[model samples]
Target: MSNLAARLRARRAHTRTRRAVSKAIDTATTTTMRDELITLAQTHGYQKSKPRV
Candidate 1:
């Protein structure tokens, strides 16, 4: 019984870790995609260049 409980706890922890990793990857992907779109727009002159302050 104790062994089963330990296994369950370990499984839950592993699941949580996997979820955290997946979320991080998703966020990074979104950020990179946004950056790429912005770059594309700038390169194509769809977005105007900002003046230096």
Candidate 2:
């Protein structure tokens, strides 16, 4: 019984931690940041460049 209770408590804590991490990741990757990343990638040659006029 005690071991089962301990496992439940651990699972709750793990769930809370996973939720926080996922929320953080969602907030960190905004559209502007994504665009900046794309530009950065192009500069670094990781993304293909569009043909300039």
lDDT by residue (tens digit), candidate 1, 1-53: 99999999998876676555444444655778756655655564445334469
lDDT of 2: 0.61
Using Cα atoms with residue i matched to residue i, what is each candidate's TM-score against the true structure?
Answer: 0.53, 0.52
lDDT of each: 0.60, 0.61
Task: Write down the TM-score for model 1.
Answer: 0.53
Give the poorly placed runs of model 1, Cα more than 4 Å off: 29-53
Per-residue accuracy of model 2 over 1-53 as CA lDDT, tens digit each: 99999999998876676555444434656888656655654564445333469
RMSD of 1: 15.8
Clashes of each: 0, 0
